[model samples]
Target: MRLFSTSARLLFNNAETKQMRAQLDETLKLFKEKVSKIKSDTSVTTDKYKNIAVDLGNGNTTELKQISTIALRGNNINIVAFDPKQVKRMQTALIQKLGVSATLSPHNTQTLLVPVQTMTGERRAQQDQLMKKLYEQLRNDARDRNSISSIRQKYLQPVRKRMQKKEGESKPELKKESEAIEKLVREYQDKLTDLYKKQ
Candidate 1:
């Protein structure tokens, strides 16, 4: 009976540890997703322009990619409207969206050409500041979500309640588990820091 009881206690502890690790892993996964979204939003890619919404001047909006085919030629984005009549409206919308950066092709009225802007000194500084702000916000969000107290409230409390209902079971080794959780959080934090530094 004594051996059986010890074995059961060990199994319960193992299960609780696994549960905590799984919760922490889920938190890490969400943080990674947010980081990826920020990187995608900041990247200068054709896909980004394809998703831009153009106001049709009638209060209705259409996605640029839906109305036109977009392709990258060298460092320029070539957008060709499928319907010739929509060309002028597309041009106006593109100009309104991209300012002077978008221009109608001289030879093709149905086509627009947008030269990709180089990261000049001013733009580079602006990008750096924006990235810095985004990185800081990500760090703050992760910190809030994975803080020790937050983890205790969301994950540890349930395990503690279960342990309390068991007869003669010693208090859960929460200090050890807390240390393990902290280590996992730090690893993810380091990964976020490295990602920011690489940007």
Candidate 2:
């Protein structure tokens, strides 16, 4: 009997993407058979296998027993004869296979998300700290901008008006300057709007 199925082409969708899958199947078969023999000999205990508990959201948890057979959703945890140390070795060998499986089928989303979730969580705490720091920086920047705007309105404009009066400039020059400033402001606002829309 064939130890591993040769339906890799069908599983992966593209008929050409079978090389990695074939290698994966061969490796898995060897690993599984070896583990099964060890278990049968009473030399290895089930407890030797590592249990990686994953949060399934809504207060549910899934224990990943074997590295090769990654479970998708609902009642995911299953028992396998492999030990934790061997499980790690299997993980490295099957990583590319896992990636290919995800790319071929949208149904693998939940399964793929599990490994990704694990990887992301390794740095999630650090990312949260960085995010808080960024938020504080932005808040302080906005406050400084508001302070500058208040100074311009409360102090700078009145001083400029007094200087203009002392210089004896008529309404015509003031009207031209005001119109130019308004046009520039409108142009800048339109540009900002366009940029926002693109984003």
Candidate 3:
């Protein structure tokens, strides 16, 4: 089950990264299975780090750039949200998807959590929702692009076949020209034979 929660415990609680990891090997394996590419939170690579989709239950995700820490929680994951409102949304998501029993307070940050409300909240929420929607849209576009590629391949296959047929049809004429050139060379000391050999 791809269950999830969020906490900044990685930032706080001084959780031994390896101790936490050692405690949760099975969970790690499950995530490795779902996401094709997994980057260690601390490791540096030559390529740009592309965001990955972790299936937090009920279609919630840690796709946002604001996710600062990812901790294992039971069979789920705790995404330490850098955005304050995202902290609340994480709680709400867990409660809705799993149960009220599943809801857990985010790891308290030394950094303040400013409670956004009213107009500001609406705008931020819209932005977050749009980000999620945009992720989905991009995925759909990739799928569609693959379909278009296949369709293009399907249409182009016939054209390729026709070109191959034309090439085949001209092969005998090419051979005849080669043979006639050879005959001419045999009949007369021809410069054309030298050109043919050079060609």
Candidate 4:
């Protein structure tokens, strides 16, 4: 069953795949009966099962129910083992039974495959609003930068230039005042950038 779950794509061709799915649909009626043998009536198995068969003519099947979560695309399969330890067990079983190697996908993302048409209109609207806000923030940041630059040029830069031009006795005092004006500009720039990051 593990081998079938892993390599249903490679093992079964187009015709077999279709036959297998049809057989699974037929067997779904007997799911309650089959599952009863493995799990007693006391244990609750409320979870929905997705079962796929590898063979239809032979009546040999791969069951996914009670073991792992399975998502099947045309030839692609995604399995999430309920027990992490079962992963190694499945790999070993596949290798020993079929003599074919299996590669497990790395778990970097927690994305799960779901049915189509699950998205709501509200969710779409929220995404659209978020993008709009982001673009507005970027535009405001640019405008604020220009305004800050203009303000520095208009009020602060001229005073700094005058202070810098003074090359006589009070040159040290003038330089100190000029440095303070530059510091204020830098602080304002930092504050604006911080606000941009928040947005």
Candidate 5:
């Protein structure tokens, strides 16, 4: 029983050691690959970085010339440059690496002007639309006034007959009501005229 227990412990220790060694080997291999690349880069004497210009699909060029710092970690390179060009290039490279197909291009002034002209035309159309709406409102108001006057005339017929029959009827009250209605109708007509003149 003692021998069996000792053998079991040894087997467990061996397996643990093997797992740790495998992990160490993998880590060392990665480290060596990174070091090899760094050594090559150091020998290459990379150029003193200047402006980076990236042409965008929108026909715009972005340039970045100023650099602040550069850092490398393993296989990754970090460049800190405020130049727009550098940023664009790096972004493009990264996208390409990731298998993105979209490419940046330049923007054209003529293309931009096309949209501007279209917007101006749209604005003019809107203005014309507003004017037409105003004219319609004026016409509707005038029509409404005419219709009201017609209704008032129908309703006042009986009242006018009764007032005529009354010998004491002052007639001034009926005259005043008629004058008020006439004034309102005149105002509506004037509004219609103003709307027409505006065009």
Candidate 6:
């Protein structure tokens, strides 16, 4: 004699699987959003330069765009500060952050002239390292948020409780359900790994 009729078992399995998949889909959506944010933050372009934080020398920091207008010239980027007093400080900040020297434009005292340099092999390697670090952080965060143990506690525990099963009892169907959840977890983990490699 079976504990549940075939139809009853099917309905239970379907409901539990649907619930688990919905959770997984929500997690995947959040993971993609984080990946998008990382890409936006790490982009190497004029917009990124404009967003770089500059120390204001009064124990405060502000973005370059807050005080200056950015313009691109042939082989150079011109950062013209709104305040003449901010020009020197802005130049120092740019030099430190960009690892390149900058000069005050002779034509405009408030303008800092920064020469554009191509990404060298060393710089490319450094960027790769940064991307690796960011990806690792994202993976760790995802794991913390959706670990197998936590999922079992949140989802499987309820099913076990409703079945009137003792915590120590090893039910075959529940075991199979756990394995299925493990497979789902692995699928999402592989997706994250693939995304990082493409970055």
- Which number leads on TM-score? 1
Error of 2 at 159 (Å): 8.2
TM-score (C-alpha, index-matched) for candidate 1:
0.58
Each prediction's TM-score versus the true structure? 0.58, 0.26, 0.20, 0.26, 0.25, 0.52
For model 1 the local lDDT of residue 103 reads 75
User: In terms of TM-score, which candidate is stronger, 4 or 6?
Assistant: 6
- Writing each residue's lDDT as its tens digit, candidate 5 over 87-131 gives 445455334443333222234111100000122455555645655
- The lDDT for every candidate, in the order shown, is 0.65, 0.36, 0.36, 0.43, 0.40, 0.68
Candidate 1, residue 87: how far the Cα is off, in Å: 1.3
Q: Where does model 6 exceed 4 Å of error?
A: 9-15, 26-43, 47-68, 71-76, 80-102, 107-110, 114-123, 130-143, 147-172
Enumerate residue pairs that collide in model 4: none
Global lDDT of model 4: 0.43
Candidate 1, after superposition: displacement of residue 174 in Å?
5.6
**Please, what are the lDDT tens digits per residue for candidate 2 over residues 1-199?**
2222224212223332243234323433433354345333332223322354433347764454533344433322222313433433333323433321122124432232222222145354554454444333322333443221222233235435834673444445445444443443344334433432332
Better of 1 and 4 by lDDT: 1
Cα misplacement distance, residue 138 of candidate 5 (Å): 4.0
What is the lDDT for 39 in model 5? 37
lDDT of 1 by residue, 52-88 (tens): 7877777988998999999888767889999878777
Which segments of model 1 are wrong by more than 4 Å? 1-12, 51-62, 96-101, 119-143, 146-199
Estimate the Cα RMSD of every predicted model relative to the unseen true structure. 5.6, 28.1, 28.7, 29.1, 39.0, 6.1
Best by lDDT: 6
Model 1 worst lDDT run, 10 consecutive residues = 1-10
